[model samples]
Structures are given as structure tokens and as C-alpha cells.
Target chain A: MDEARSAVRAARRSDLHALTDLRLHFLGEAAHADARLRLMPDARDRTEHALPVWMGQADRVLLVGLDPAHDPQGPGADNAAPVAYAMGLLGAVPPVLAAQHVGEILEVHVDPAHRGKGLGDALVAILGEALIGRGAQVLRAAVPSTHEFARARLERAGFAPLQLELERSLDAG
Target chain B: MAATFASWLQDPARLVVVAEEGGRMVVGFAAGVVLQGNGWQIPARLGRITDAYVARPRRRLGIARRLAGRLLDLLYEKGVGTVRLAAAVQNEGALAFWQSMGWSDLETVLERAVPVEGRDPEA
Candidate 1:
């Protein structure tokens, strides 16, 4: 691969298959770091159905990162497959909290072969901008406690530990 | 606090369970919302424990333990396969209390303040 590009664009309905493929890859990789992320039988079906609707929502965003390095026989590089993706959602905390409005970064994933090329950073930046434009005062993300690499990436972007979530199986409840 | 409880009581998705031990007064409560699991991580429905409290004097009578068990019973019976709750890192007591009930560390929620357009971080 030569001349890596970090260009990104809003996802279109045509990108549904690519988005679903990347989502499963993200889940598969995450399950390695945390045993809880089992891909359900309906994972593919749920995501495919959710993406098109999300892409058009004003408070939600789906972005695709392009890596022209692998665009074959193309002059404009429009056919380059999406090598990275990031989804953002605007939400509000419970009315009890002072910081009511917030933005959440969900399911951030980049192709393994395309790492270390600033593609992930670019995608995060774009999503952050989009979320900010929609009146999000705080940006939030959650990652497996053992996934240090992902945590470090967000930390470098100025994220700090706000809270810790704990869970356990229901038998003892 | 009363209004907050009232709001939760009004919302159909929110479940507010209170414990009254041996008196007409309320002693403690556990509240949560029925939410789907984050992203596509877990296929089953999720119940997020939004608030839990037991009066100081009511501690260690196994009141909290029993209350938590009851809360989980209702959650799981309602189709929630996983339950999660957030607590401040400094709240070691809360952490220990939940740990004693089989809860363990799952995820860390990270946050960043968005820079105001006209403000400078260095300034």
C-alpha cells in the first residue's frame, strides 16, 4: 500500500453491506479482549436494519473512512472500500445530572491492515465535529477494561476516566 | 430527590423499588431502566441500575443483599440477560458492596469536555 489517504465521508445507503461487515469485525476483535461480547445470531440482521435508519437521523451519524492506497484502477478513488468506521449518537443524561446533553461514540473500528495510518484518528475527529454541531456538550465512550489500546487512543484525544461500569452474571444477582 | 423519584415512577420503562423494613417509613430503594445492551455487544436486553441506596442504620442486616437479589429477580424475569451499573472510582464502599454480590469490573466510561468555539484550552 502506497500514499495512504485518511479521507472520510458520510455513509450512504449503498454502504450498508460494508458497514455491517466492519461492525462484525469490530465485535469479533472486541470479544477477544472481553468474553462478554458474544456475537448473537441476529447481530447481522439487527445492524443492517439499524444502519439505514441511523444514517438519516439528525442526532446520529455513520461515517466511512477511505483508504485510497488500495483503490485499484481508479482515477477518482470513489470505489475505494471503507477501511474504517465510527458511529456517534447524541443523547441526554438522566434529568438528575447537571450535564444533561451528551454525545456517545459507539462501535469505532478500523481494518486491521489499515492501522497506524491516522485513519482512526481522522474518523474520530469527524464524528466529534458532527456530534458537537448537534449540541452535545460532553463526549463519552465505553470500552472493555482490558482493552488498553483503545482506551489510550481516546485518552490521547483528551478523554479521562469519568466512571467505571461493573457487571456480573444473574444467578447470584 | 422527591421529584426525581416521581419522574421515574411516571416513566413506564423505569422501575423504582423501595424497601420498607418494619415501619411505615421508607428505608431504601433500588431503581433502574430497561434498556438494550450497548451497540451490538450483547444480544439480550439490559437493565441498568440507575440508583441504589440503603439508610446508614439499615446497613448489614442483609437488607441490601436481599434487596439487590429481589431487584435482579425482577430484571432477569423481564428478559434482561445482563445488568450493569456505574459508580465513582472513589466510592470503594459501593464497589465492595456490589462485588460482594458477584459483580465485577466490566467497562470504563471515558469522558472529554468539548472545547467551546471561542475559548482556548491553553488560555
Candidate 2:
């Protein structure tokens, strides 16, 4: 557990390739957890292209967890790849009350092999700090209603339920 | 309010409809935006009614309904395949209002305060 916690850190520009793979993995996990989720064929390509832009943004935060014991073989090896990642964006809400800035957790995922450790909590803590540093007064996340595990994690991490998104098909009528 | 209205007016993906009395005084307004569904189970373009307001004096006159109807029509004309709106759970009047207009409950939004560091959690 300690090893896994230590492996987590803020994602850097050099981690783009690993970040892209982790994003695809996260999408697959999301789909498997919910039958309603359908992965776009170009999701991988889009993630690869968008990661750099999102990472470069001042209002965005991305954190990654690496395999604690990963040792590079020589060259072109799958060394130091991220085992998990969490991305968030800072946004401004309509001027209400004393708080205006809100931080939204856009996506978070941990590799199957890295489950059961405290890596997820570590990532959330780091990201929360980053968001607070950026002047966010509140943190928000929209977890899939079907993803109970993810929802549980967020609840345990000091996030409270925000809104229920109900949807119906217009084509039904 | 001015900046928000201006931005919404400028966004091509959004539609703003206003009900005016005597062609000058604004009585009510409805605003909506076209949201592309996340390629999951929801693949169609969605029209989300972000805000709708009707003057209290204009209540029961169907001005709000007319504004919403026109907004929906414009959204559908723009190729939106679905429409949705959210109302506070405690506001039974608003709920009934939307229901009467053919909008059904979708999801309830829950909000939680972020606990400040070093603060008492129970507080």
C-alpha cells in the first residue's frame, strides 16, 4: 500500500503516451461496468490528441500513478507506464454566495492490477489540493449511476452527491 | 446577468426565446443549448433547457408555455432529437409546471460541501 501511494504523482508532458493508454483502459472499464456505455472507435486517437492540450491548460489538473517497481529494460520497453490517472478541470459558476469556482473531476481510472491499494485515494487527494490551489471553492464529479464502485470511492474521498441526472428517450413518443 | 445573456445570445449552439408584451416589455424568457450525447447509449443530440423564467404577473397566462414551446420547436428544427430540463426537488410548483409541459423527471442533482482542510468534518 505504501509503495502504491508513493507511485502517484502529477502527470507531466512526457507521460502523454502512457496517459493515452490509461484513458483507453479507463473507457473499457467504464463500458464493462455499464452496458449503456459505448466506446467511440476514435476515442483512443482523440485522447492522444487532446491530452497535450488539456495538460497544458492552467485550469486543468492531471495526476498519474506508476508501477512502483517498474525498471526500464533498455529502450522502447513498457517501463514507467502509468497504472492510474485522474483528470479535473476548474470552472467558474454564476456569481452566487461567496464561492464561485468549482472543480470538476472529469475522469478517473485505476488499472485492474492496481486495485485494492490506496492509489485512487492518493490521486484524489493530490488532485483536490491542486484544485484548491487554483482557487476552486467546491469539487464536483458526475459518476455513472451504474458505477457503484467508483461512486463509493468518491464518497469516501470527501465528495458529496451533487445532482442526479435523469434522462429519457425523446424517440419513445 | 447582462454578460451571461450576451454570451448565451452569441453562442450558435444555444437558443434564447423571450415573450414580450406590447412588443417591448419582456415578460418571460427560455434558454436552451444543444448538447451532443457522449457516444454511449445516448447518441442523439440533446436539447437542455438551461434556464426558464416567467414574470409572476404573467403566470397562468401561458406565456411561459409559449416561450418553452417555441424554444423546443427551434431546438427540434435545429436537429435536436431529445430535450431535458431540471427543477429543484423542493419546488413542487416548478415540477408540476414542467410535467404539464411534457417534460418528465430525469435526474436529481445532489450537492455536497467540500470539507476544508483541518476543519472539523462534523461541522
Candidate 3:
């Protein structure tokens, strides 16, 4: 496949490896750019094990972007391997506020070779739409301050800066 | 708000605390919740300061600080490793207040509105 050809769809069981591959790439890139996200020695093992269980979850949506070069009319239409992936989780804020169901985009990644092909934008748009179909009234994504590309990607996908999350690590009590 | 309070009061993993004064008047309140982490990405148990509010008349009176301290202590008692909270960028007072209480900026949360109809993306 030369370029991604509108082949994005919700991930299936058969797409587990593909999903893990693209997601890991995003995490790896994140860790490379930010020291705070250092990976442990067993990071790959742990993530690999958790991904399959995550794939089976009903409250999460995982999307895959395939390189649609295989036969379009036969069972091989979707046979091409996935070159990108995006995921979202169904969640809600505290009910004290005007509580509404939310879909949070946790990660979106396209393979390096697939970059600049608009695959990332396609994944986010479709992922957001999918989450809305599943009853999400609002959508949110948290991006690190240093990652200009990631933030720009979200902005291009229609996300606007909403809130700043301040954090403090507490001593165990 | 009443329903939410009632539900939080009945949940074990949630912490709801309020400061009272003058024998019966409620001056401030704080809320925290614990979450089960996936162990790989996040810690096993995490805490979040979902809401914290103090009456306008009670501003800078240490009521919110005391409430926040008590709420965080309760979260620590539950074995949480870290705690987080979000405040809108425009809420300078709230942000500064949280900073004084020891929280610092960590992440930027972006939001998008999903229309009720015609959400199907053509791309």
C-alpha cells in the first residue's frame, strides 16, 4: 500500500497485534520526548498483556487504520494490515456538575511511514464520531505541554483547550 | 447536586467532606475519589480531587485549605499514591488556591463538542 485509503474502522479481535503495535509507537514516542514518562523494564510485557483484555471491554473504543490496497470486492478488502490506531474510553465527570457522558481520546498514532498522509486526522475524526454514537455528549483529550505536534493534531480535529489538570503526589498514609 | 451528594455519601471509595461554622452553617465542601489503575500505565490506586468549593464570604479564611487538607488525608488513608485535580484556565483564583495548597500544573485537557445529530465524519 502506497498511502492510507480511507480504510479506518473500529478494531476487531483479529486486529489485536496491529492495535498494540501502533499504540506502543505512540507511547514510545511520548517517552522519548518526555522524561517523566519513563518506561519500566517490564513495560512491554505489561502493556501486551493488558491490551487484549482492553480490546474486549465494552466501555472502550479502539480504531484501526488499514492500508486499503487489497481486493475491495472480496473477503480481502480489509486484509491489509493496520497502519494507525486510536482509542477512546467512555467516562463522566462528577455528577455535581452538569454531568454528561464523555468519551476521552487517550491515544492516536499512525506509523511513521504513514505520517503526513492525513491518517492521524482521519483516525481522530472517526474515533470522535464513534464515541458520540455510543452516547458521549462531550469529548476530551489530555496532551502533554511539550508535544506541539500532538496538540496541533487535536486542534485540527476540532478540540479546544478547556482545562488544566494540576497534579500532586501524596505520601502514602 | 443533592442526588450526587447522596450517592457519594453512600459510596465507600468516595470521600465527601465539608467545613461547618456557627454551629450549623456549611461554609465549604470538598470531594475526592479513588480509582483502580491498570498497573502498567497508572498506579494501582489513584485519587482525584473532583470538587472543592468555599462560600464567597469565607474567602481566604483557611476554610478551603482545611477542607482540602482533610480530604487529601482521607485519600492517603485509602492508600492512593497520587492525587490530581483540574481547574479551568480562566479560574485564576482557584488555580492559585490549589497551587498554594501544593498542586501544580501537570496536563492540559482539551475538549470537543459532539453534536446530537450528523456526527458521522465524512473523512
**Candidate 1, DockQ to 2 decimals?**
0.50
Q: Considering DockQ, where higher is better, how would the candidates rank from best to worst?
A: 1, 3, 2
Q: Which parts of model 1 are misplaced by more than 4 Å? A: A1-6, A68-74, B1-14, B36-39, B57-62, B118-123
In the order shown, the candidates' DockQ scores are 0.50, 0.26, 0.49
Put down candidate 2 lDDT per residue, A1-173, tens digits, no spaces.
46666777778887898898888888787677654455766777777888898888988999898765553243543347788999988888755335467777778888888787777877877777677777676777776667777777778876666554544345554
Choose 2 or 3, whichever is better by lDDT: 3
Clashing pairs in 1: none
Error of 1 at A24 (Å): 1.1
lDDT of 3 at A137: 81
TM-score of chain B of each: 0.81, 0.88, 0.88
Query: Tens digits of per-residue lDDT for model 1 on A70-123?
Result: 543467566666878999998877667685568899768889988887777777
Tens-digit lDDT track of model 1 for B16-123: 788896768889888887886645676458888888888999887787787787888888878777788998777888889998887888888899898787222332
Best by DockQ: 1
A87-168 per-residue lDDT for model 3 (tens digits): 8998876555677788999988888886786778887888887788778888999987667888899999889989888878
- lDDT of every predicted structure (CA atoms): 0.79, 0.74, 0.80
Best by TM-score: 1
lDDT of 2 by residue, B46-92 (tens): 88888889989889998888898798889888887678776665677
Q: Looking at candidate 3, what is the lDDT of residue A125? A: 84
Give the Å shift of residue A6 in candidate 1: 4.5
